[model samples]
Target: MGNTDKFEMIANIYDTSERIQIAKASSDAIREYLVEANSKNAIDFGCGTGLVGMNLLNDFNSMLFLDTSQNMINQIKQKISDFNIQNADTLCFDFEKEGLSDLRADYIFMAQVLLHISDVELVLSKLFDVLNEGGHLLIVDFDKNEKVVSDIVHNGFNQAKLTDIMTKIGYRNIQSKTFYNGSKIFMGHDASMFILDSQK
Candidate 1:
């Protein structure tokens, strides 16, 4: 499926997805990055159904919930079911399309969504452009996506390559860590995170 289709599809079920629930370690990661976020302003790129956004509602001052799928954004609205979303706004966008100017944010977040991009260079470059001075970005997903999912998904920016691309974009404090047992067995949904801090 294309990026737009991801959320339209995920939006239907992401509230329960293992990735977005803010696990203990995952929540710790988010808190650490966001504490340095400096501003409550945030942008959630490819925020399918806002599942990740829901976890972060308390973290941001105002949120520009962005996705390529209008249907997905609509699904987010449907999924959230009327929380006090006054501080929330939605935008239809594709990272490769390069129109990231609706609003700038101190923080940019992508969760369970980064690997679905084919053009990390363009997207990260644009993200760097849109970031406020001393901003940060937190991206969370599997270092290894499922084979079936990968076959149909467009997840090209794997961890090592992604770290390289973000560094090329001048994003600082780049770190990547993988989480899994020594067995290397798939536990259905495992935890892995890449946290990037924008020094621009």
Candidate 2:
């Protein structure tokens, strides 16, 4: 089954306090590197249940919450309706199999989404195409953790290697730092989360 299928089953129960806390932290990290967000359109790529994107709605003029699972999109849509969020929208999309659409954004942020992508370079390239010139791409994901091996997801990522990959994909001004360290955060093992900021 695809990752979307796995996430579909958990969409209704995805917003536990732990996840909310993590999303808040990730949003805070992204906020630190943000520039002129109020004038920019942003995309919360792979946004699940709108946890992080919902918290960041006020920062951007408009926010697009994109995810692969329709159920997750439904959950986010419900939250949008319940909160009367006027500046946010939702799209159920899969970057892996789909060609680049007309979608474009001034800022693109992905929280804990890179680990699930099997072809990281392809997705990054597609995201690059989706970004407006000089747009920023912020990625929040776990640092390398050798102890946490899995078949469906990466153990974590090496910041330097990731920067190299992003650089190759044509992203500039790449900067990354570990911002949150939590116990049992990655595959039931202690892991540190890093935020990467890159410009297109």
Candidate 3:
């Protein structure tokens, strides 16, 4: 099954897994790097079950939870209602297919999302297009690990290589740092995760 389909099937149990702890760590890192003035509007691209975005609702004036799985979006919507989160909303969008030309945000975040995408450059280009000038793009994903294998997902990313891609895509002030190390997080293998902070 495709990653979207898999996520759709698992949406009910996704938030209950150990992955939610990782999302919490990612959200904490994002909070640390976020510029106070640039936190007006944010988009949590590939936001699954709103784990990370839900933790950051108070940081942004408005939050858009975008994902490909309808089930995932539904979970986020349910959370919004349950918490009475007025400034948060959800969108079921597959940027890989529909594109992001109509969207704009002051900050865009992707946690454990890029590795699943088949065309990283295409997604990065579209993210650049959607972000307002000087907006920030915060990405948290695993560092390169050959031990983690997957047919549907990229093994992970190299910080230097990712920085080069972001620079070529018109992002500035590119900076990345490995922030977490978890056992059996990726394909049952231990892996480290890095957070990339860049500006448009």
Candidate 4:
């Protein structure tokens, strides 16, 4: 099955898995660099089951959880009703097929989403276009690791190269830092994850 189908199959169990714990850690790391006051509207791209974005509900006035899997979006919608999250909503959108040309946000948060993308540069450019001026783009993904091999997902990313790409796409004040290291995380190998923060 494709990645979206795979995610759809896992949608029900996602929040109870170890991946959710890792996502919580990723969200905690994002909190350190996030300026809560500056984020009025945020988009959680590739938000599967809303693990990270749900925890960040207090930070933004409104949040849009976008994902390719309808099953995933269903889980997020359930959570929204369960928690009475009036400011949170969800959309099943595949950025690779349908672009975010009309949609905009004050902050765009992508956690562990970049590696699954086939065209990173194109998506980054689209994200830049969607962000308002002075808006922030927070990306959380695994660092470059040759130990992990995958035909579907990327092997991860090089910080310098990713920064360069963001810069070329008109993103400024770029900063990246390796925040989390987990054993047997990526493809059953030890991997380190980094957070890249930039402005549009």
Model 2 residue runs over 4 Å out of place are: none
lDDT-best of 1 and 2: 2
Q: Which stretches of candidate 4 lie over 4 Å from their true place?
A: 36-39
Give candidate 2's error at residue 168 in angstroms: 0.8
Please provide, for model 1 over 62-152, each residue's C-alpha lDDT reduced to its tens digit, 9 standing for 90 to 100.
Answer: 8888888888788766645566566778888777865747568888877656567765577778888888877877776655544324444
Can you give the TM-score per candidate against the true fold?
Answer: 0.77, 0.98, 0.97, 0.96
Candidate 3, residue 105: Cα displacement in angstroms equals: 0.3
The top-ranked prediction according to TM-score is 2
Clash list (residue pairs), candidate 3:
none
| Candidate 2: pairs in clash | none
**Candidate numbers, best lDDT first, in rank order:** 2, 3, 4, 1
Ranking by TM-score: 2, 3, 4, 1
**lDDT of the structure predicted as candidate 3:** 0.90
Q: Which is the winner by TM-score between candidate 2 and candidate 3?
A: 2
lDDT of 3 by residue, 56-106 (tens): 988999999999999999999898998888998889988888765678999
